[model samples]
Target: MFFASDNSGPVPPQVLAALTEANTGYAMGYGADAEMVEVTKRVREIFEAPEAAVHLVATGTAANVLALATLCQPFETIFCTPTAHIHEDECNAPEFYTGGAKLTLVPGLPGFDDKMTAANLRATIAKEETRGVHGPQRGPVSITQVTERGTIYSLAELQELTTVAKEFNLPVHMDGARFANALVALECSPAEMTWKSGIDALSFGGTKNGLMGVEAVIFFDPKKAWEFELRRKRGGHLFSKHRYLSAQMLAYLTDDLWRDNARKANENCAYLAEGLRRADAPFLHEPQANMIFAALPRATHQRLFEAGAAYHLWDGPLDGDPNEKIAARFVCDWAISRDQMDHFLALIA
Candidate 1:
């Protein structure tokens, strides 16, 4: 019973099968394969942006950094929440890739699970670029769809944030490392969540869902397409055997596999949340998509760990008082079964 992370889950059979099919023949390197062409077309159609520019990288960090670099200048600063992955988890990759562009933290609305409210975003943006050339200029505004805390922003909320960014004429970027999970959870069209909501670029993710490490960077307006291609190559993120990435993404977009995977993951989280609620486990944030943050006693955690249930403690160490409560993160992936969740819950009980 592994509830550690979706990154530790198994790849879907369909993605592996596509990789095998792509391995049989020689193809042009650096994203010239026929499969890549199809992948681009598919992503464009899916997002309803006919002129969108789509490129692939092996990691979500690369996708986010390269996309941000294309939108921001070195003297500018990106706006994001304190808990954003680009800010807390990416090890300053965005700053490095953007040539020292800084990140300005926007305060999250209280009890909103680390989401930046429009008023806070506007205030933060307004505070920047006021010092002329002395201070960092305001750059693209980055929004995390499924926030680092695992709570999702509704369509209206997304539009509200983007609208605030547009007020200052700044480009908007979405760090969508869990794009499919948020998409399926919101029950909205891809266009409605992105370009229609004024997002300029997107980090379309697949690795955490089911693929074996492939993420796409999509620019709704192709004006910076050439610059992004150059930045990707210079950043050493351009894979020579690019078709393997293309194959996995193609398979993910085929037959609604991406949506199906995310749907199952969200459903699994819901089921687990129900069981946790029944057990009187207190939640730090509502289980919005495929991730849960709940508080359990130290003794209960120890019991589950001894039983081989894997997860992360968010607040403290495992050696505290037995009755002390510690918060933990539980991630449900596409591959986990009801039996496994039941086994995990039984251990908790």
Candidate 2:
């Protein structure tokens, strides 16, 4: 049983089939293929933003950095939580892509998953630009849906943070690496979670859900569309064989496959969480979407690891005291079956 990460999961058959279909003939390179056109149209219709500009990249980091570079100036600083992917996981790609724009860490609510409150965001934004030209200026505010800890922000909570950004006239960006997962968890339409909530741009994700590797960067305003295209090319994220990316994304948007995958993943995580509860394992955060952070004894972890069960320990080393509790991360993807989860739970029992 593998529960390390959704990134390790298998691609959906539909996506592979679409890639095969797109591979048959000669197609224009660099996003000129017919598949890309359909992808743009579908994303626009799905988000209800008729004038939105959609572009695809092979990685979520590229999608996020390119989108942020378009919204922020070099002298400005992006606002995000301490645990945000752009801050912790991207290896300063945001700063590098934005030509030296820095990230300002905004404190989240105490004891909750790392989600920035409106008050905290406002305070952080206010603290910046205090020294005029000496300090970094305020730039776009980035919100991570299905936060790094796997807890999701409700529609109202999303709107609240965006509203705070609007107060300062700063554009808002969503690092939606797990966009579909958060969408399915919230039970909201694409528009309600994004533009309607005042998000200026989005990094629409697919790779973690089921696609091979393809993420879309959507600009709701469309005013910065050209700049984003140029930044994407300059950043070397523009794929020459762009239709492959387009094909995967098109297949994801077709037949509600994206939502279905996310639903299955969330359901799998829920089932696993219930089993963990029965095992008397403590949770670091509620299993809201497809990821869980729970505590199990080192001996129990060793047992699972010996059984070839894959996952990550969040606290101390694996060689610690056998009875010592260690928090670990478990991610459920769409491909994992109930039998697999049952097997894992049995090991825990």
Per-residue C-alpha lDDT of model 2 across residues 149-173, encoded as one tens digit per residue? 9999999999999999999999999
lDDT agreement of model 1 with the native = 0.94
Compared with the true structure, model 2 gives a TM-score of 0.99
Per-candidate TM equals 0.99, 0.99
For all candidates, what are the clash counts? Answer: 0, 0
User: What is every candidate's alpha-carbon RMSD to the true fold?
Assistant: 0.8, 0.8
C-alpha lDDT values of all predictions:
0.94, 0.94
Global fold similarity of model 1 (TM-score): 0.99
Local lDDT at 185 for model 2: 90
